[model samples]
Target: MIARLARQLGKEERDLQVLEAVLEHQPIGITRIARETDIDEHKARYSLRMLENDGLIEPTPDGAVATDDVEERVREINDGLDDLIDQMESLKDLDG
Candidate 1:
């Protein structure tokens, strides 16, 4: 399960960063997410919309929250990333 997310995250680093930002700050607003993650607001908004479509996050009264599935997926992905960071970081800037 995590392997799949890791693979997807490798291809979608920006999306993963947005996800990571959301994971770090629940019920955070889009503007805050862009600032905290160092992502452009447009990109963050697009990512947020996509994440919602993917069922990774959902809207909250104050902002947004990661779905239970997303938290679990993130945990699994983190546990398996010991050796993959350097490789992924190298390609993080590439647009998918």
Candidate 2:
């Protein structure tokens, strides 16, 4: 069960990385975003499009910029991750 949850979260982290890269470096290009995040262009584009569709990012004349809601979502994702980590650490001493 923990392994399955970890796999899910690993995917979420990738999406979050794409979001963060766009928010920080935009007006930023996909190639550059790929380099910054160490993700391939294909993955970068996929994330960009998803975020745009979700209203988390905008493709401006400059580049893709994160919307206000994106930041809030990112914050929430981060906080939830912290809580998960704490739970895992606490459970380390327990027998499964």
Candidate 3:
């Protein structure tokens, strides 16, 4: 179960990297994002689609930009992941 969750989240992590790239370089194109982030153009496009579907980013003629909602949601998700890490650390004793 944990392995499955990790696999799922690994994809999300990549997507987040793409989102970060877009946010950092607002109004940039897909090809440029791929070059900047060292991701394949196809993978970058997939990430963009996911971000768009989730309302985290919007398309501009030049490229893409993070939505206002993205910053807030990114904060929330970061906090939640921090909490998850703490919980996982707590489990170490149980395993021992």
Candidate 4:
């Protein structure tokens, strides 16, 4: 379960990297995002698609851009991650 969680965290980190790239460089393409994030094109594309499906981003003729609600969503995600960290810390206490 820990390994699965780690994998999930890694994927989320990658997705966040892609999102950051798009947020920083609006009207950005997959190629540029992949280059900037140091992720492969396929991963970048998948992340973009996931973001779009989540309503955090949209596709434009020029490229991809973040949605107005992106900041709010990011805040919520951060808060959730913080909660997860607390829970994980509690779990670590089990080893004691």
Best by TM-score: 4
RMSD of 4: 1.4
Each candidate structure's count of clashing pairs: 0, 0, 0, 0
Q: Model 2: clashing residue pairs?
A: none
Let me know the TM-score candidate 4 reaches against the reference structure. Answer: 0.92
Each model's C-alpha lDDT? 0.82, 0.82, 0.88, 0.92
Candidate 1: which stretches are off by over 4 Å?
1-11, 75-96
Q: Candidate 3: what lDDT?
A: 0.88
**Descending-TM-score candidate ranking:** 4, 3, 2, 1
Candidates' TM-scores?
A: 0.63, 0.67, 0.79, 0.92
- Tens-place lDDT per residue, model 2, 1-96, is 879988877766777788888877878878888999999899888888877887888888877888877767767767987998899899998986
User: Any idea how many clashes model 2 has?
Assistant: 0
Give the per-residue lDDT of model 1 (tens digit) for 7-46. Answer: 7775468878888888889888889998998888998898
- What tens digits encode model 3's per-residue C-alpha lDDT throughout 1-96? 889989988888889989989889998788988998888899899999999998999998888988988879888879998998899888876953
How far is 78's C-alpha from truth in model 2 (Å)? 3.0
Which structure among the candidates has the greatest lDDT? Answer: 4
Q: Model 3 off-target regions past 4 Å?
A: 1-6, 90-96
Error of 3 at 67 (Å): 0.6
- Clash count, predicted structure 1: 0
Residue-level lDDT for 89 in candidate 3: 88
